[model samples]
Target: MATKGRRALRLLGAPHITVACLLWFGVLTVWGTLYQADPLHGLHGAVQRFFHSWFFLAGGVVPLPGVQGTSALFLANLFASMLTRFERPSRAIGLWIVHVGLVVLFLGGLLSRQYGRETTLVLADGEKASMSVSETGWEIAVLTPGAEGRREVRAYDVRNLRAGGSLAVPGVPGSVGVVRVIYAAVVSPAAGLTPSPEQVTDAPAASDPRMDRPAVVLRAGDERLVLLGEGPAAVLHLEGGGEAHLLLRRARLPLPVSVKLIDFEKKFHPNSGIARSFSSRVEVDSGGRAREVTISMNRPYRHGAFTFFQSSYMDNPRGPEVSIFAVSENHARLLPYAATLIMFAGMAVHYLPRRRRT
Candidate 1:
């Protein structure tokens, strides 16, 4: 067992491990670069799908180790080298400093990946919002009437559902079982069907053809109902008494403060219809205190751990103008700067000592 352990240590500390990881890293970079030309992933999609994953498909066909896997192995190789290869005092201190810098950079990246969040906040003129919704994730919201005629809301992430998934909530009659999910569908009323005031129009006219709305069929005991994303929520009458309303919506995150859009201004070049810039003036309400801030093309508003950048605006000359802010919350935002400084210090120390000797 002791011999096996020594062998394992030597294998981990081998120089070839580092070489192999670097080779794979280069391959992944090139693969992702080539894959981004296709529309499936887009600019950010390649990094999200391939670079950060453990294993991902190339061209949706070939399998390859992702950047995360290669990085982890490279870190392990460096750690093993520190333990077994750098034990002697004669080793160059400059090289050790460089390694330490690299370790710090890697650790910072890991922390950012684990804790960082990116979302968007959209507000029409004079509108206020306290929560921002996610761009991708979907949720099933159950709205029921509570005591004193107040409404209560409970949300469940749709990612947790499957063909036989069951949901049991308090005050709900029987178990709610998912029959099936239509990932993309256009709900149309049957022929000779009468349209109700709550019924939504079938499939949007200008929506992307590739895009699909989610629809679900759920069963509770003997009753079954179909819920469509384009229409009003399916209202279920409970056997015990009250009513339950189920609607599909984007997952939301609460903000530390609420923001109200005061005004949106757009500038145009002289004698041209082209836009020069756009800005939004917003009032932030935290607790009972209120403050006003302006966000523009290059300017961002920073509060606590959140930063809001003016990203876009809707074109509405006659109606209320809407502003979109790209919200980013990253605890390790300064990690890259610190890592760069450490690397510069390492290089300077290495070169200055050698120059003095010369």
Candidate 2:
């Protein structure tokens, strides 16, 4: 009687609970693999639509407040139920670890997406800015009158400073003139190469009296401002309003702290031209405490809660300079580590053979 009851209970649970868990995992795997390759394409949309509809139904069934961590909770419960029903310790441990890892990964993603901040800092040969813009690509810079009473400091959206577009200030009539950007291969002053025929052909007429250097022209109403690349700084013209800004998409860095690239070194294989290693020497000053660190390809430098990894590289006339550090910090990183260990151990025990006595 007991055996029959046990079998009956297993049959009852298998269809709804077990099948649901399998379906969820299968869908998640498929979605993850295909989402990146082609996001807006066919199966991706179908999968998204299916999940949306299912989630809607799930919302109706579970209700709001109770469903705070519905997906995670559901997965955890399913794993636990299977463990209890099957009496398979190794399988249970593996499932538990995998579920825990998923939970951690999800939590990490949530925290980073909601609270993570990123930005880039563009430092001229010797110039520095008071603050770094956020890297997610939108910026609003406010340029106020300086202490000297001369409005020297200019702030605006870097994204709005496009090659061929007029910018207008609010309440200010008219618009800034679009600057023409021409690309030409001039005689390399350092290399002493002759100018290409294309450069000669495309050169503006001497009668036009154009600026020799690369420049951008800004015309706000009757006022005209010319910004040249050879100049110390770009001149941003403002109207009567104190709040004149430009919006541009650039990498942003945190304020009060500045990163200076002291030196960048790259090492390559002797015979083969393949790169062997690269490193960056940088100085980071936070709240007056200065520290110097070297960041290498795989090796990351950690300070406080933040970590910086050697990410990319670029070559210039001076030398090859590596872009050191993709920085990030997250609170829930350990959960995934723990879950990985558990999953590996469980799988090992499940697969490996044990000695048997006759």
Candidate 3:
């Protein structure tokens, strides 16, 4: 009688669990495809709701000898026991490796999500920064007092600034000129201006400033026009745009270490015009340890806790200079590597032995 009752419960519970899994899988598939277009769309919401509903259902339906999901644990242990009992050696080995690898992968993902740091540092043609800001995209400017005075190092959050927009510098009156960001598709020359299909009634009226032959006329307030070249500073003549006390300065973040670009080298193969290598000779000063290092395409330099790689290069007729470093730190990056190794080993053993047997 007890055996029959247990069997009946299993029959009823199996379909519910299967249906719940299928629903979750469908939700995941739809969410993955549409997430980019409309992140807050209904499909994403529905997936979260479905998971919560089914997880609750699963909790109630599955009987536990002690706690709730403990039943899953017991079921897994029972399957293992059955495999061993039936002398299914190959299946048991495969299952053990696969399960262990999955567990390791999950733990690794948790660690990385909870603790990962990524940052970018931009040094001018010959400037140095004292701190690094990665996620917030802000750089700290450390101002050591000059021989005559002591000014506290000011912290500046510099991002891509608009051409006409104003930025407030603390203790200094008026706004500074931040870089103007122009989207290639949205900007066109005044001589060749065309209305965009997606342009709304409230869109700004401006011409695209091309890099080939660049010119910008930025309006401040309701009046005044400032003509800007590609240079660091531009003058604005304003009727009522205040006294123009602040000069327009480009936005840049400060780094902890100072880097001076000593020299840049670009080389190509002798016979073929194909480029062979590009590198930068940079002088870096961190923690009073000053050293010069050459960072090339795959080669990176390590200093203390930071690794600097040659990530990009800029070429002009005068000379070609390369940018160095893309920095990242994840405390739990080894788990994926271990999982990959385990998977590779399992595939090797399974296939090599099968081939030998054949």
Candidate 4:
């Protein structure tokens, strides 16, 4: 290697650089915890500022390195150390394996952050579905009823739309535009106004974003329709004697496999209204085959890259029970475990001796 190149590698592998990165990492952890304690900046804000970004504007002005940059620097240090310091072969085999394991852990975390997804799968007894819903994103769907009661759905993402912004929905005549969006509101019938009256007024937005009930006003053809996130579908009669149902709802994600709620059971406390435990018997159908599995409080079911846990349950006074599963997809699910095992083996090789020194 060139003289400059060798010097740069030595600098990268310096112990002081490693120490500084570790100290910065600990500072970030402490600061993130303290920042989340404030009501204005919750856990999401802290994560976005500290973990997601490479650098953040400290106090909305000065730039400061975050966990992302720190991790990158730490990784560079490890690589440089392997290339510059651990150049021998006879007695450094275990050290090489240990370094490789540490590298895997850092790279695995990066891959997981880029590809991991978290969503909810909701199913009622005897109902099977292959789609999960996003927790915070909202969409507008237009459903046209077809033969055999099946509806053709055309959904548009409206989470980024501002007040009075428009959406050009396919197969719908004229313009479809949004007038207003309320994050949380009280919706009611507007009484004697025009042909019908759909009234809505604003309310306080919930701190937990999932609890927010959003409403959107859309101009479909010539009629103005009010659609609520968790409300009933509004119908718009088309010019050709057909009708389209308008709905504002959480965004749905298509899944690789279908899951059905075979049975849902929950046990209450000994004598109180609080629930003690719940479980779901689900049938996962994939690749033309089906199998049954139980997902309970601590036991989660894994299929392919997705894992499902019994997150919550709901009991209707007049209807059936609903089972909600928290599903997460992590492509690097086993990387951490593999890295840990490799590290342990390397440590044993480096330290353990069968017949010598205590």
Q: Which stretches of candidate 1 lie over 4 Å from their true place?
A: 1-7, 13-27, 59-61, 88-97, 181-212, 239-241, 341-358
- Writing each residue's lDDT as its tens digit, candidate 3 over 158-265 gives 334455555444433354443333222233234233222222122232221112222223334443332222223333333433222222222233455677777767
Best prediction by lDDT: 4
Name the Cα RMSD for model 3.
13.7
Query: What tens-digit string does per-residue lDDT give for candidate 4 at 1-358?
Result: 6999999999999989989999999999999999989987788778878987799998899998988888889999989988888789457767888988998898888887777878899898999999998887788887886779888887877668777788765456766888887778665555322222247778776545667788787776677877777677887766667777777888887888899999999999998989899999989899789999999999999887888989998878788799999988888988899999988887777777533566
TM-scores of all models? Answer: 0.79, 0.47, 0.40, 0.73
Candidate that beats the other on lDDT, 3 or 4, i.e. the better one: 4
- The local lDDT score (0 to 100) that residue 44 gets in candidate 4 is 76
Off by over 4 Å in 4: 138-248, 352-358
Q: Give the candidates in order of TM-score, highest first.
A: 1, 4, 2, 3
Identify the leading candidate in terms of TM-score.
Answer: 1
- What's the TM for model 2? 0.47
Q: Which has the higher lDDT value, candidate number 2 or candidate number 4?
A: 4
Model 4 scores a TM of: 0.73
lDDT of 3 at 307: 63
Q: Candidate 2's C-alpha lDDT?
A: 0.49
Q: What digit string (tens of lDDT, one per residue) describes model 1 on residues 1-358?
A: 9888767877897899989988888887888797777776565667766676877776679887788777778887877776677676345566667777777787777777767777789999999998887665567788888889998888877768787987665567667888766555454465122222233233432222224466667777776766665446877776678888888776676788899999999999999988799999999999989999999999998878788899988887899999999888787877778878888887887789889999
Residue 48 Cα positional deviation in candidate 4, in Å, after optimal superposition: 2.8
Which TM-score value belongs to model 3?
0.40
RMSD of each: 5.0, 13.9, 13.7, 5.2
